[model samples]
Target: MIGIDLGTTYSAVGVVESGFPILLANEEGRRVIPSAVWFGDGAVEVGEKALRRRGVSPVVTSVKRLMGRRPGEVDDFPLPLDEGDRVRVLGRTPEEVSAEILKELKRIAEWRLETEVRKAVITVPAYFNDAQRSATKRAGELAGLEVARIVNEPTAAALAYGLDKLGEKARVAVYDLGGGTFDLSVLEMRDGVFQVLATRGDTRLGGDDLDAALAGWCAEKAGAGAVDGRMIKEAERVKRALSADGEAVFRVPFVDGGESIEVAATRRDFEHLAAPFIERTIDCCRRAMHDAELSPADLDAVVLVGGSTRIPAVREAVSAFFDREPDLSQHPDEAIALGAAIQAGVLTGAVRKVVLLDVTPLSLGIETFGGLMNVLIPRNTTIPAKAGEMFTNAVAGQRSMSLRVLQGEREMARDNWRLGEFEVAFEPAEKGRARVGVQFRIDENGILEVLARDTATNRDTVLEIRDAAVDVDDEKVETMVSESVEHAFDDMAERVFTEARLKAEELLPAVEAVLSQGDGIVPEEEVAGIREAEATVREALDSGDANRLKAAVESLDKATEAVAARMVERAMEEALERRMGG
Candidate 1:
């Protein structure tokens, strides 16, 4: 059995070895894979190697956003390809692209374990809606793995933690903020069963926003001429560095008017730029707690995941809000992936004692008169939830009527996004006399299915919400399995080379940038204080101490809270201004 954490920024695979869940290293003997892919020359390359050529490789980093898009949804960019390329997306879909990445992860897992693995469990956000869940299932098929269950990320984290908790039941809050998404979940564990009380999150919000905000601040403070895409990317790395160090400084050399100016960024300044983003997460935490009908005081423990959780201020704010310090024993990046492997073990009957019962994130409803929305199933309802609503003909002798279904919280139909629509034709009848019953059901994975029947005609109509096919056929899965055995190459060597290159590209300048900004952001007396922290991080980054790098990142985050807070205020102001103007 194998488990996969298909995260927005990175992916990882793991399995139980010698009675302990150990993350299986990639072809490079490293555990994590960058959740990025490069498109070139009619081929798709994933993970670290794909991330290396981000700009040059026509990479797609946030395909998760497009998972359940409706017809005519605009793509961020034309996929990296020339006209007449053999891989035509118009004939394909986002699921296919995502599946390609999953295939790569599976290949790495099978290669490292030296085993034939045909089944696994995958983890996703607890708040993911039906369309998103269905899309994931399809991706699993495309990768040639039978997806036994789509476990929620937070629930999985709790399971991984609760496995050691034994028979005691505890109310736990899982705070997970990954590269591209954030989720807060409240769960209850009793007798080995993990039941989710509530889950809430902003699917579009995450650590990436903090990096962008901090980078923009760095540009403004140093007057770095103009901010470019690469500068923004650099700001992200710098912000990541600030999470572990108390104060940092570096010079960002760039061109302006035939001259070069070295722009500097400090950990303090970065935090000032990012404080508001952290606050946003706090707001989400509050909401999730409310939805669960519990207060922070009710939580037994707050478990953190995602790279962003390493920030000191994030920990402090969470601690302050909940009136207790968070438990930081788990590896933020590896916990979810490890939990996924455990779930996989459960699915394969290697571990048979656990079951996960999760819930949907939003209400499912239909549009009614005056653009009002009538919800059939409210958000946070346990899955596999089911509800039925009756329909009638509005006009005499009307034979058919259209049903528009939406998924969201708004009262107005226009405000809520339409998941899909179906038309039910009824037998000819007196106007307003025909009775039709429509049943909406959400499965464990959160995928929606609708069935309608005309009572007068005794005819049944069913609609399966349609999406692009990433689901593979039997023949394709067989072929992929064969390719796995026949194609032999050095996967680890390739992964290591890619990770080392990316690390080198991201870190060296990161340390120096922190040093350069020290003079401007801290007092003269504090210079040595900042330098000492910087020195420790420099040694760790140089020595390749993952823990040290991780610590340095958090220390920097604490020193820079004021800056991140200011950025948060600015973001909130801009949002308010936009709403006011509208």
Candidate 2:
């Protein structure tokens, strides 16, 4: 048996070897394959080869986002859809295209194992509905592999993280922000069993949004036409570069009319462009925790999974939201594939320890300040859902917050019907200092109850919201309840080499320019400091630690700032004087 993570942007395969599960690399020694397919000149190419042919040939990418979704269901797609919501591309449906990718993965696994793989387990987003799940299985079958089971992405990640620590009892939330989709799953692990309590996600959101943000910025800066696939690919490259170093350059030469587009981007610039998407993920995290009847304090850990989590900004945001540092032990890209392989091992008697997974349905949340629906429970989630969140005082001296229980599809709190409204109070304190842990529990009887605990005074408030009577506006209700890469190329040392070198390129030029003219303008003490900083940077540049070089470059940039400022002032004065003399 083989396990496959059939991802949106990339796909990976794994299998048990010598009683341990490990990912199987491709012919090029890559653990993951780009989820791209190209067809041209009566030939079909998949993975890296196909990805490279993006602008040159008819290639389809990011098809996973359209999987199992109807044409009307999804707002838009790059490809056209048939009457059945099947993606119509070159007379092939999305499933068929997906099957092609699957076939390639099977090839890799079979080649690596030197055995014919007949049965395999596949993974999908935790929030995927029955239709999406079924569609995924169909694609697997089309690839000529027996679809053993469809595992949830987040569940697989949790399995990989907790399989070794199953003797302990703890609740964890797997925050999976992959290349093209996001899934937030709350799970409880105890007694060698992994149980998913609640799961929520947005099928349309993920790292792709981040890339698009940067790509759009690139296009705008280039004054180019529409955002093209080439620009997007370059953006992905620059995004990866920005992940480790301070900045990277996106250069596209010989463009339309013999021009070029070159833009320099810092990590902060990318973060600013990607902030809204990150905030949306944060919103889902809050909602999923509430649905699982968990406060930030309840979770033993928030395991960061998926390639997007590699971004420093993303890690910081998750840390801020959970009030704790995210668990970074798992390799962001390999954990899911490993978990899938573990599942395969379980089926083949190579491994033990069972995993029980669950999901949520329509989102259930409440209205907080700004009339936004803070989801307590996401839709398509399994029944008997319970979750919680920690609310803080928005301002100092605030006595209470009006808790409006809301249910529906809209993001705005006012658009959803209110089951009830009440006040939850805590001791007055400085802003964000007063904390209230609010938990929601839905019993098997379908009763919804909410509990608010004031941490400062240890006071408890309970509200049985089910008895409050849901607003009977069928129209409003109908409008509600809605739908829910680190390149393996080069080792770490080689990967950071270019970015660190680029940082050096940017720093040394300005440093040299300033020192050449700063003899009289800059103080001798600061010049010595600048020289020392530059020497340290050069020493680090000679060493193998790219990260150390980045830090040293930053220090040198700081040390030379005053001198550079003086040079700039003198040059401006010289230019003004020259203009007056002329």
Candidate 3:
């Protein structure tokens, strides 16, 4: 058995060798495979070869985002869906395209091991609905591998982290921002057991969105024409470069048939462009921490997973949110696959003494009176578990009742996703009738099953739902924290600017007064540095960027410290002179 990280942008296969998990390199000696498939000349190509044929052949990438997605729910679907809830990728189903990528990964593993690999564990985003998970499992089956388990990406990363730290008891928050999805999971490691306390995420959020945002922003700022696939690829390259350098140039040739567009953006500009996506992930982290009932101080470490976390801005954002630097102990791209390999090792007797547990991503419930959501299984509940609630007929002499099953983080049923509804036969009785018990059972794969039982006559009505309205509850996540405090972000930005401006207004005058008193106390080179800092502060003030202004003002304060000490000395000398004269 091997372990696979079927990612949105890249995929990898790993296995346990000598009780140590390692990712398998393919014939090309590449450990990571780009999650792209190209259909051209009646043949299929996968990975880097396919990614290179972006404009030539019909290439499909980020197909993971299209799984179980409606035509409108997602901003950009790699393919169009057929009538039967299937996507047609240039006559091939989305699953088939995904299967091709998985098949390549399997072949890589088989070649590395020099043996047949069948059974495997795969990882998915913690927020993936049952529908999406099922699609992934089906893809695995199509790839000639038996699906042994479906582990959440964050949980898998945590498993990798705890593989070497089994004896340490600590709480960890895994911040996973992959290519097409993002999830944050809070977990605890105790005596070799890894327990996920809570999980929160937005499936529609990830590095792809950041790339698109960067591409569009650069084109508009460069005064160039509309963006295209070429520009998007360039933006991705620039983004990767910005992860290491302070600034990078985005260049797209022949953007409008003749004119080439060139845009240079500092890391700060890119961070501003990427701020909204980061803020959304931070919102998810806040919810996950709240659900886990833990604060930043309570977490011993915050583990970063997925390729996007390599960006310096992303690391800084996570550090700010967690109040501590992220633990870069695991490879951002390979940790999930390696963790899955560890789990596979545990199951196959290669590894020993470890237990793993995961939690549901959202609250599950049914609609009650007045369109309210009555939560039966709250978000963060331990999975492979069951919860039940009792209800009665609302009207007198009712023969049956209709209930809408919902999943979300909202209090209103209408605001949540209606997973599906079912009709249960109710015994005729007066209002507030006999106890009808409703139970929700969720398995380790996050698939849900609902059962309604009549206590009076012991009759059971079962309803099984497989399809989700959308792959992610992005609408609800958008409102999770923003709606709670309307205009708070905008107001906070204004407040930040005002505060920074006030500091500059006060600090500049104080420095000038000291400079006017005398120049001997402050060195000429130091005086020149203070003037340069003041000019930089003024430039930042004119820019109207709160963060930049704040940074500049702080720098100026540090530069003028010598002058500030001179003011104190002069004041003391004047006091002594006045006393002597008196």
Q: Who wins the lDDT comparison?
A: 3
The lDDT values for all models are 0.71, 0.78, 0.84
Question: How does model 3 score by TM-score?
Answer: 0.78
lDDT tens digits by residue: candidate 1, 1-582: 788888877788888775567788876887888777777768778887887886554566656655654444432322532233222343456677778778888998889888777877788877565656778888888989988778888887887888777589899999898876788899998887888898867556677677667666766766665565555567667777777776555445534544443455666676677687777778778877878999888889999888889887788888988889888878888898888888877766666567778887777888764455678888788888899988777567787877787766655556555766778887778855888887889887777887888887778887767652222221122233224234323332333333443444444455457446643444466556555655665665576554556666456555445444655776799899999999
lDDT of 1: 0.71
Off by over 4 Å in 2: 72-85, 363-582
Query: Deviation in angstroms for 280 in model 1?
Result: 1.4
> Each model's TM-score, in the order given?
0.73, 0.63, 0.78
Q: Which residue runs does candidate 3 get wrong by more than 4 Å?
A: 78-87, 426-435, 454-460, 469-475, 478-582
Clashes of each: 37, 23, 0
Candidate numbers, best lDDT first, in rank order: 3, 2, 1
Off by over 4 Å in 1: 17-19, 70-93, 222-226, 250-261, 368-372, 411-415, 466-582
User: Which of 1 and 2 is ahead in lDDT?
Assistant: 2
Candidate 2 lDDT over residue span 30-137, tens digit each:
998889999877788999999788766668888887665544554445445566535466677778889999999999988988889899989888755434565677
Per-residue lDDT of 1-582 in model 3, one digit per residue for the tens?
A: 999999999999999999999999987889999999988777888999998998665678888887655544554654444554545657766578889998999988888888999899999999888778877888899999898888999999999999988999999999999999999999999989999998888888999898989999998998876667787788889999999999899988776678788888889998998998999899889988887898999999999999999988889999998889899999999999999999899889898989888888777899875566788998778888799999988667888778889877565566567888888886799967766899999887787889998888889988767545444445455465344246556545655776788789878887787777675777888988988999999999999998889999999999987777877888899999999999
Candidate 3: give the clashing pairs. none
